[model samples]
Target: MLSNRQLLVLQVIIDEFIHTAQPIGSRAISKKDEVSFSSATIRNEMADLEEMGFIEKTHSSSGRVPSEKGYRFYVDHLLSPFRLSNTDVDIISDAFAKGMIEFEQVVQKSAKVLSDLTNYTSIILGPEVFDTKLKQLQIISLSNQTAVAILVTNTGHVEHRSFSVPANIQSSDLEKLVNILNDRLVGVPIVQLHEKLSDELTHLLHKYTSDFDAAYHYLKGALFDQQSVQLYVGGKTNILMQPEFKDVEKIRSLYSIIEQEEEMAELLRSNKDGMNIMIGHENKIDAMQDCSLITATYSLGDQQMGTIALLGPTRMEYSRVISLVNMLSKQLTNTFHSWY
Candidate 1:
């Protein structure tokens, strides 16, 4: 356990380091308005804190930086409630005031706004379309041999694929197929569409069309082949501006991981509901070992819709980012719930 003075000293050091991304000295803590101690007394507290594994002296200087354990303690015990500035509130309000109609549009805008506000890389995992019930599906003919298959979910998310129509299939058969699909799969969740099609809808297709097997194979491949969740990333280059990421190799490794959308989507999805913080090595991804990940989940009623995350150096503005994420998540939930 830390004394009250020790906790205050640690918080001040971490807060300063977070802002400047530079090591902090006891003299600096003494200069803060809230700190009442002399430099000598603050130095003694700093030494004690470092001995307890909360802070470390950088090799090149006498100034101290918060270690991973220090950051953890600060997040868990020392963080004060952050009040949102009017600018922050205005930015978020303006984004939602644009009359966006789709969930993807709202989430995409949120990601961009978050990145712009904090200058940190922002990632949003869009709601799992599989869990959403199919609202409608249509196949529109662009030409004699080309057509587009469009799928819309109850949440107003749209997915479409354009493919060449098989020569053996007739236009009338396509209409019949769509009618049968709407009748049978209207309320079915998208995740089960494949199994439901194979197990139950195949026989119905065979009864309506002469080229049942070939057409079934083609339609399935065209519509349900790629069902993975979508990941939206913004300000990927913003991480380049952080002083800690000056190393070229570090940037390269981080970029490679971000490029793997599937991996990132899985990582975001694995976080539990509400706010979560992973500092430095606490994050499982090797490339993220030098960074902190702050994630907050947005929901529709009781069901979680997606995650909004900010990634930056371990010396992140945790209080402000946490407040922003929490507010944004609530706004997202309210917007989504209004739809239902």
Candidate 2:
């Protein structure tokens, strides 16, 4: 555990390394970038910081650089909101605002902008189940024994499934139940749908009639299916050109993590409240120990949770990347809310 002063010194080293892609020395921290400290005092702080395993030296000729511990500490303690210049914000906003006909297209544009701006891979996620707000739901009777369930969310994502209903329910009764369900559930949370509907199930069936049992069971089954969950991934190939990941084996390892649905889902679900930066080894994934992940959350309407993230080597562009993502998240929130 280092003192607050020592931690600030380490954060400077890491931020400098990220910006210049060069090893940083004590003189750099002591000199004024944004802080006021003398060179000798900075050197003492650097030495103490190094002893605490936060920064390390590469060679006798080179300056001290941030260690994995240093990066983690810098992110958790010393970081603050990074402000973007007006020019940078305008360029990306104008580029993406041309025409986003579909919500998927908007997500895709975010990935491209992240890669183009920082030259790092970006991951933009759709609403998690907990973030999903039901905009509409209806059951369409295809026949006496089967019905098609259509569900829509405020984010414009749509899901449909064919359910095998109980043999006894008439088409007219199923049609009546559909109207009943829609009025009550139009703005409900997807997470609350099952229990909320279940609470009203007996009342719904009795009100619709005794013939509605089969349709009720089928509706429950449709809601529980995992197909209702959706994941969107783009810019997966953008990081391949970085010099830090030119090695074939390293590239393959990173690809494996991105390809796994569970890995991406776990990453999106994590740290919903604050901007999260997971450094080497601090993240449980062995394959990503050489990389850093910076993630932030965006809200959809009042009911959905969305995430924006950037993936780069341990030597990532911290100030600029943070600024870009923060602004982009607000843009996304504005765009999402304006739609409905």
Best by TM-score: 1
- The segments of candidate 2 whose C-alpha lies over 4 angstroms from its true place after superposition are 1-52, 57-65, 73-87, 95-105, 129-131, 140-148, 162-174, 201-203, 206-211, 225-230
Per-residue C-alpha lDDT of model 1 across residues 147-168, encoded as one tens digit per residue: 8999999888899889999989
Off by over 4 Å in 1: 142-146, 301-304
Q: What is the C-alpha RMSD of each candidate to the true structure, in Å?
A: 1.7, 4.9
Question: Please, what is the whole-model Cα lDDT of each candidate in the order they appear?
Answer: 0.91, 0.76
Compared with the true structure, the alpha-carbon lDDT of candidate 1 equals: 0.91
Lowest-sum lDDT 10-residue window in model 2: 224-233
List model 2 lDDT by residue over 166-223, tens digit each.
7777777767777877888778878788787788666877777555566577667876
lDDT of 2: 0.76
Candidate 2 versus the native: TM-score? 0.74
Candidate 2, residue 286: the lDDT equals 81
